[model samples]
Target: MTRETSEQPPEIAEVLARWQETWPTALQLWNPYVSLREPQWCLTTAEAREAGLQDSFAMIRLRGLAVVVDLETVRKLRVENYALQVLAHEIGHHLLVPANLYDYAGLMMRVRLALAGIEDRAPLVANLYADLLINDRLQRTMGQDMASLYRHLREKGIGETRIFLWYMRIYELLWSLPRGFLSCDKSEPVLDADASLGASVLRSFARDWLDGAGRFAMLAYPYLIEDALHQQALREFAHLSDITSAGVGAELPAGMAEIPSSVFDGIVDPREEVLQNAPNHQEADSPGRAKPGSLTAIIPGSDASTGPQQRYMQPGIYVDLMRQIHPDVDEDRLIGRYYRDVVTPHLVPFPVEALGELSGDVLPEGTDPWEPGDPIEDLDWFESALLSPIVIPGVTTRRRVYAEDIAEPEKEKPYHLYVGIDCSGSMHNPRRTFSWPVCAGALVSLSALRVGARVMACLSGEPGSFMETRGFIKEENEVLRVLTSYLGTGYAFGIPRLETEHLQNAKEKTHLLIVTDDDIFSMLAAPRSDGQTNYDIAEQALRRAGGGGTLVLHARAEWRPQEAERLRQMGWVIHYVTDENALFDFAKAFANRFYRSQGNPTCKRP
Candidate 1:
């Protein structure tokens, strides 16, 4: 895409000429197997912007494993001669801190937790922490002239905001440079003290960089709390910022919805640590630290201990974290993934099918000319001899083909699943909070899919529009998208959803499972749009399905006696879960009862 342009000056041309040879050396600094494509050489600033290297002379795009450099901006920043330092730093982004897309999202997740109310400053804080880790390793161990490169940038009259000064002060402390060498002599004792702590954190968590992310962000929080100071830092550090858009246009990373329990241990504030360890305060009597069991010391965003099933971040917090990482992420797809991640750990094992012995009689059907590649066992020498007394290879070839009159094996397949969830105004939104009904539906449906069963998931609310899969399908995401969605329109699950075309024409036995509350009995007694009542429709649906049906209610068993008995008389097994969390237990039992195995005498075929 590069073309000739008068915008390219002689100095820019000179930097481009030598930068090609610098890539291999940058790669070697990491390891011998560290490989990357050649960096995009944008001859002018316009070309650099087009390549998405905006506001920085060099940047890396994690989506394509691409490195982009603007020779013009490199010269403008007056660091054209330090190609190895710049290229290796960009390479360091790929090799180390926030290495892949998942770790990048992880880094953002931790940083967001630390910066609670000031979350818009996450990208800036994350980028700074990443740069510190990469540049520290390069300068201290790899023997790259990273300090000289930074000194040049400092000499460029970059405004020394508190954040910038504090940032540079940490570098000065890390490298043992004189106080004014990188950070000008404007440093105060508070800045020096924080810088000391920052340097200590960098060294301690160098190998486990993601663990250090929260601490570093906590250190940078106060510096960036004010909007004006953050804007100044952005303007001053624009040329050095490389990872601000690292996750743009990249696929969303999985497993980020659940934060590991150990992550909270690394979120200690450096300032708080210093106060707790000071000699004047007695260790046991110190008030600097939070009480042992309190969540006050934990990062403010999510508490893993509070979830009903497996520990997970809040849905709204997860959505916010993802949006910060990828601005254009679709909220619908993101919310679906959040609940899918939450319910994954609670799903049952895939159902196993029993194998019966083959019972078939082999009988000769007809003879055909055998090709040279045909199996020799199938050749009929007598038939070939009848065709010709003297055998010519291709001319006298004959083979007897056999057909098998095989009786079908006794092995049973898993029943297809028809899962209906109530999405009424009473039900909590799964996107904003945890919804046990949605979780139960996902757990059972995904387990069904794992066992080679098709699933038709429906979300219904009475007296309002309903959402469902196009039909019974095998796609997990489509099924989840329907379950995780909220209708919030009507009172209870629409019983007429049982009259869908897929259910009416099902060829195989299907387990009909509906999750609702006591209100469903009210809906069941209500009449349908047609002349028949919903009770008649429910009975017909059970008959058409041919498999036993189950209604899982989030209410006490004694709540609806007459209606429950009528449905029970129609061959629907009523499972009552008084607590919402009990729904997962019901799902596990239901799957085991219906889909576990064919030979298990304890479970009857649905």
Candidate 2:
């Protein structure tokens, strides 16, 4: 009996108390790992909302592997007695289809690609597909009456929407139910054929669920194309959308930037698959050919594992796609990680400090026990043998410590990096577009950190605002966060940024690298608060840095002859590139020249 129609409303305490006892059987249904926590049994709808179960009686949160159920809603729906099936289905979401946050994101990513124009429908479609896989497994393999739960839900109304009918029919086919059973007898040849294709996809890709996400979405595409039908289906099946918000407040999944080429190859439409499989089917010019004007050729998903050349989604597209997956993900972190992923492949080896091989260090002063945790190279086999014929780690192993002569020169430490980039109105926002300047900055800044150098990154737009690290720091994220941020303000890199206290109090020699266009010359010429212009600040900061400076300009070499010469005279090396992409080449060459074993040498400036 429904809760309201009964003589008295069911006590929420009594419902929760009863369901609490059933939680064990629900968990045991999956034969899950012993440590899996029991589902959170919220006693009321308000409690359910707080537990992240939005519109459903039960929901799963991938962030904490949390399964929440509203006992109030369960009682209202009269499925309080079906606690095992409902809770087990929620558990199946955690253990099966889109189990963890990463695979959930992967499933959404593939579905979004398939539902290209109507991508917002992806979450609904993904939730439905996941339910199909989970419910099918529960019903057929595990002997759970998942169909009965749908039948109880089907009492409200069985809409005539093609997507809804096709969806329900799939369940009917999977459970060997009659045609009119769950779908309200709304059967048609097209609906039946499509339902058969979907059922086949569900069973075929049960083990490899992510691979079938695109195919399932493609099957639902035609039904969802009409706005009216899509909206109707959404309203009809709103209760089943347990995982629609699964990625909310979740960490951004790693390695999503690189999509495998085979992923797109697997994005086959089931209708097309059926056509090709038919005996009467005739081949086109080529089988599996992408439609004209389609992105098949452009969006090449080369696997990094198999080939050196790996393809990445555009920064803007990736950001949009990820936002759909994770609504509240930090945009700065996304952009920072994006550039990091892109530049990782191009990163050269961290410069090896060429401390000329240790000289005058032959005197063995003492021997110490060498634990197994110590480097194998440190073990002195002769001394260890003398202690015992058989060597035993930490017991018989010995390492010889030698004293070096005091006359040897101290090893040189790497110079700190001060990277300044112009985030002027002219610059594109790296969050929205691929900013080569930001990419190049990430490359160099991360390289410096890899070599154990402290770096202070600054993004400046003069006459407006600027941002930078607290001081010289080794944190890659902090440096990258600064490099990738966009300040669409003034017209140039604020030359006065060089006057920061960090540079003034530098203990080690610091290299200043500024990336900007010819517009920086305009900012440099503008007078500062003091009578001295920014030109004086640049020269003075260069002197204070003590390690010299390089100004990488994305401008024609002949564009600003006099101003460029003035900076060159201030002991600044000037490199000009007509194309912005060459900044990466410049950073690579600059790191190679200064950090290599060849010793401190000037980069060949253009």
Candidate 3:
């Protein structure tokens, strides 16, 4: 198992070769795509560093679809079952623990939540939980002597913290061993009765691990809540896991994504749900964002008579989880997801059943009976046949007749929705993969489409590529596709791009919505091809379209006074917020004011 060669050492390699031959027999499935490689073969020490691997050889990292292993280290430790057991554990991680990128993110989300106050060691604690689940599976189902691996690991054990000891005790209980099975102190393990219960509970829910995770974390909450305990634990285990190396070692393999995000939607903090469903639970006034002192995580399925609620999980918990899952999750996108998830239930989808926005030409789907005054063309013949028994002198199904309002005379007003979003580098959250502006843009675009309005979604990142839907169309999917895509090249939103590409070509009076930061000043400052400034182009577009507009800027008060004032003079609505999060509020308010109560998509002022 020595990592001395680019090739696997003959001695350890032989053991693994034998195991590899029978690996498929055990897994009962063949995956030609997976292969084994030595540490140097899979990735050089340098490559490992680049992938953020810890310096320790005790850890293995999966990267580039291959698991990186230092066989020599494994051989030295004389692990139980050698490559067979250890390799299986790593493969299990790929097969189950993470499953996909979103689940991988879910892994961190659940762990950080479970660790709450002792989040500094969240990754470490998470690794322990994962190992427990994996080992228990192998020992219970696969019939492997996985406990032997821990026996050797504990022999070199340095120190014990309450949480760590409690963690180990669960292992002891799982294996039917005494409490002091793997402790360095050499004294009888002073164990929490909860550990025995946790071990029992762990087995009880092994088949359904994700949901059980939230519950297990609740049990471990008291053991990890204090810094005094954490410090003492750190001091006790200094030789075991260095605090600095904890994060790096705890990292999963590079390129560990094959799963879609939709799979993790059901993954939630069980405690949060319990708290949410509490009999006395009261939602914060501003449900769009985390309000101060508004968050609490009660014990899942806790008895009401058990003293006061064991509450935790304060504000910013989700933000912390997001940041931890990946350093690059877009802040605005998270904000958008949060607001969208929160406000979506509150939003009554546009009253599509009501033919309120119907053009006087024809009727839409329905089975409502026609009255004597109903138009003959609006009668539902099929519905009338279905209800033939109730036939009467002018009784037939007809869509409730409603007259559409016109924004302007001489035109059949179908509201034109123009969304101009800043797709510049600033809109990109390197930590996260998606754009929030795109999400927010999607919400509004979808709303407009639901109400029979044409949506023109434009992604403008000045001095770079600009994308827009083909003028305005009613297809919701097409509109959503354009809004959620990202263009991370430009420096700011291109006002000229909007003028030349969107506003100038608008076929009808359009409700133009621009999403950008104060940096839009620079885009406005950029010169245009025709001698006209970007501002002039923007102003003229509003005038030409003759539809009221809104500039939703994530900028400071000092940043917007002049341009916001200028845009206001041009009959544009200026809504400023200190952060992108408030865009959701603006969106909800705008939808309520302009689209919700409307009888039709007409180019008329509210």
Tens digits of lDDT, candidate 2, 1-606: 222235454688878877788888888888865446777888888998887777688888888888888888787777776778888888888899788888887888788878867888988999999999999999988998888778877875745677888899999998889887789898788788889989999989999988999889888887888788778888877778899878778888777776667678667778777777799987554322233333353356321121124466667767877887778888888887788888787675654433444566567788999998899999999999999999889999999898764443345666788999999999988877677788788888887777677999999997899999999999998899899888899998999899899999999898999999999899888866669988899999999999999999989989989999999999999999887767878877777655533442222222
lDDT for model 1? 0.82
Q: CA lDDT, every prediction?
A: 0.82, 0.81, 0.56
User: Candidate 2 has which clashing residue pairs, if any?
Assistant: 261-301
Off by over 4 Å in 2: 1-14, 32-34, 158-160, 226-228, 276-298, 301-310, 345-411, 525-534, 591-606
Cα miss at 598, model 2 (Å)?
A: 11
Cα displacement (angstroms), candidate 2, residue 259, comes to 2.8
TM-score attained by model 3:
0.51
lDDT of 1 by residue, 137-159 (tens): 99988998788888878877985
Sort the candidates on lDDT, descending order.
1, 2, 3
| Pairs of colliding residues, candidate 1 | none
Where model 3 places Cα greater than 4 Å from the true spot, the runs are 1-52, 55-66, 184-190, 222-319, 327-442, 445-509, 514-541, 550-606
Task: Order the numbered candidates by TM-score, best leading.
Answer: 1, 2, 3
> What is candidate 1's TM-score against the reference?
0.85
Q: Estimate each model's TM-score.
A: 0.85, 0.80, 0.51
